[model samples]
Target: MAKRKPAFVLGAILLSLSFVVSACGGTGNGNSPASPGASATASATASASPSQAAEETAIPSASAAAEGTRSYETDKGVVEIPAKPQRIVTDYYGGELLAVGANVIGVEPTAFDNPFLKDLLANTQDVGYPTNVEKVLELQPDLIVVMYDDSYEALSKIAPTVHIPYGTATNIYETVELFGDLVGAPDKAEAFIAEFEKRAAEGRERLKGVVDENATFGIYELTDKGELWTFGDNAGRGGQALYNALKLKMPEKNSNDNQTLQLSMELLPEYAADYMFLTVYDPEKKGEALENLQASAVWSNLDAVKNNHLFMNDFDTFYRYDPIAITEQIDLFVDMIVERTEANKK
Candidate 1:
């Protein structure tokens, strides 16, 4: 008998899992749910200042609005949503809703493998993909929380739908807080947000002595087509935890807004950092690409590669933008950085 590798064990559990297009809408667009056009006036709101938005919409006690439906302003305009929705259908943020203990009766199957949502959603019905308006209607949900623009109208006909602009938020905490208000769990949301902040602060303090303040980090993904992709802000691929929560510095080109940037192999050096995390969607294709890059003089000369600071990240753990996933990402990132920094000292 041999000691089992932890990565192998984790990979075995996640090997059968399929990657969904991140609700935060990262690059490569392959796994994203299709959004057929529908005539709904509600659209995803543009990325607003989270602090300002939070100030405007204070989290009220769950009982404060318990009597009846209330008019809530959403990206789709002011629509009345149940003050305490019993049956909720969420296309993208099902895991986040379940984290706050919302009564989610239906969800997209893509979220089925989410470790955080595994037990909670075991009995929930699959409402097909986000584009399956007919399946969603059959569920007779009291509220529909959507992330895409085109699915709004069709679902709204079945129930009031709120559109949360995917990949637009600046921080995960703000998004969680907003979702809390939508699902009538403001207090729980706030409590989670506070806990996230406290943990992030503690991690930052703990890493100050381990990680160099000036050390820069870079995140990239290789698609099945062999293209390179980078993310920013609320976009997927752990941007919120690595750059925002942990306060790690990133290269200038990678520090832009909440959008994914595509890069060519020739331009790899421009975005290379003191540390790099590479994600691969298709093992065979991305593995070939990784091998080719390893042979390149340009890649060989990069600071991170030469210093052995490159890490391979899994899609399931690192690609999520929700609160529960973000918390996990923060811890993982801190541990990696601390371990690497300490190893370098020896």
Candidate 2:
């Protein structure tokens, strides 16, 4: 009797098979719409062999289609996508895609540095900062998930494309749920959200007890040009985790601003809070920026600086709006607030 492969081995084999088909340009004919700009010259190799042509022309196998795909309405339009896509190419939000267990095959270079995603994406392809359509075609993605509309037309030529609005103040939980739905992991998405909410609530409670009830928090980043930029909930930038989920108070002046503000160093006191979270745009300029800021009596007098409550955060880790990163940020926030509050008491 022949022995059956273990589940993990079989899964790996299936994944390899999917990659092969995608790399060779299997478009899942029935499941995907006609390529908007697919050229005959580009697809000639995909149809070279009769067997390959038949495979490309035939509809997705009913079983595979039923088990692995569904139609989704996106900003671009309604489109069919694999239920559990084996080869995914994402422009931004690779963190959210990874959080939902999607098999990401490609992402922008920026995502390559993300601490949580870096190791996982070691073998993933760099699809270019603006996305190289030719490279994307070579990867043969089952789905192309993008945050920008600019790359949609080019990517749609290679495979099914879906657009999720990025740079909006969309709640992280809602975005996670949407990603879950897109990747066919709605249950997992909901579970993660529930866990996040529970943890956030716990963190908020902990902070309330350790810190002054009226104490406020602010997050800022120093640009390469030595400018200060304050973040808001418009995009996460740790704001959602701190101000929204953890219920950390923000200064009244900043409470209503939904977008990031570029403030001069002299105006630091106006937006200063009891505790400050800082990040740098360019690490090369960090030392100089810190030196310049510290040299200023104005910056020295701010409560956060005077109280020694300024915390420096990594740019890739803290600036992300994805659920995985947000959850991690929340954990860091709780620890910092608790430790600082305790130290201040001493």
Candidate 3:
């Protein structure tokens, strides 16, 4: 998600259903749902402990099962979602929604852009970016999952709209379960979480031999503005796999930031690490970005660049940070690391 501007829009309270949305400011001891974790720009990783982490997935209070709907707690408020949501139109979390057996009929541009999702949702209709009120209403989603409140009031007229703020769930594990619970597929969520962790474990084992325990990794992106940005552990752009799954150490500067930090060409050499994954956001601006960096005597001379350690990646593929996206990213990154390491040995 390179400078991701979430476009999950259009939501409203459904008719004949009582949706208890979290009030702006609530009582200190009220039964208000927990505050949604902030976005990458302002949020820190408030990951709960293992036991607490499981609980933080947020337990939903059951209601009206006879009506084929359940009262579920969301980052925003208590939502009345269909027990088996047949037609879902969501924004950023489409990948997670699909994972939890959601029958997604429509999606926003962000979800439609995800490589895996693009193919899976190929037959689906696009709701457009910033979310068109007309398209969402036309799609006729039984459940509308949005991250922002922008279109809530407008879309509420058509469906049961639920808001789950972006970056609310800290990790893929919590994210999957949260959606699973929302769509009444907890069994699938648990199974997927267990399997996903297993995949991470296997990926970790593969790197143990080839990648040095202390090898530093960094995620670099060339922006449309012809700027360079380096991301840290939780900043997406494959950071989850690079830092979390593989446990690769990031540069000391980034290890602390754990988010994105801009770098001037002169300063990039200082931030370049043992391994770097570079993706250009817009190829049209690559000359001004990567080419200029390559021409920079100070930057090109850096060991990471000269040693062929800075691998250029496709922007669209690299920027999709959903669970499905991250799964594929892990394999690609591991192969790249192993290939680079083998070449270094020679």
Q: For each candidate, give its TM-score against the true structure.
A: 0.76, 0.75, 0.77
Q: Encode model 2's per-residue lDDT on 108-154: one tens digit a residue.
A: 77776656455667668988867799999999888898766777887
Query: Model 3, range 190-274, lDDT digits (tens) per residue?
Result: 5544544556677888888786678788888766566677765544567666666666888866642335667777677778898
Q: Which stretches of candidate 3 lie over 4 Å from their true place?
A: 1-67, 74-76, 256-258, 283-286
Residue ranges of candidate 1 with Cα displaced over 4 Å:
1-66, 130-138, 149-154, 283-286, 344-346
**Predicted structure with the largest lDDT when compared to the true one:** 1
Per-residue lDDT tens digits for candidate 1, residues 15-130, read 32211122341212221122222112111110112222222233234564456998999766999999877778877667567545576778777677765456556667887653
Question: Best TM-score goes to which candidate?
Answer: 3
Q: Which pairs of residues have clashing backbones in candidate 1?
A: 42-76
- Residue pairs with backbone overlap in model 2: 68-83, 69-83
In order, the Cα lDDT scores of the candidates are 0.62, 0.62, 0.60
Backbone clashes, candidate 1: 1
Ordered by lDDT, highest first, the candidates read 1, 2, 3
Model 3: clashing residue pairs? Answer: 11-152, 12-156
Question: Distance (Å) between predicted and true CA of 201, model 2?
Answer: 2.3
The window of 10 residues in a row where model 2 has the poorest summed lDDT is 19-28
Stronger candidate by lDDT (2 vs 3): 2
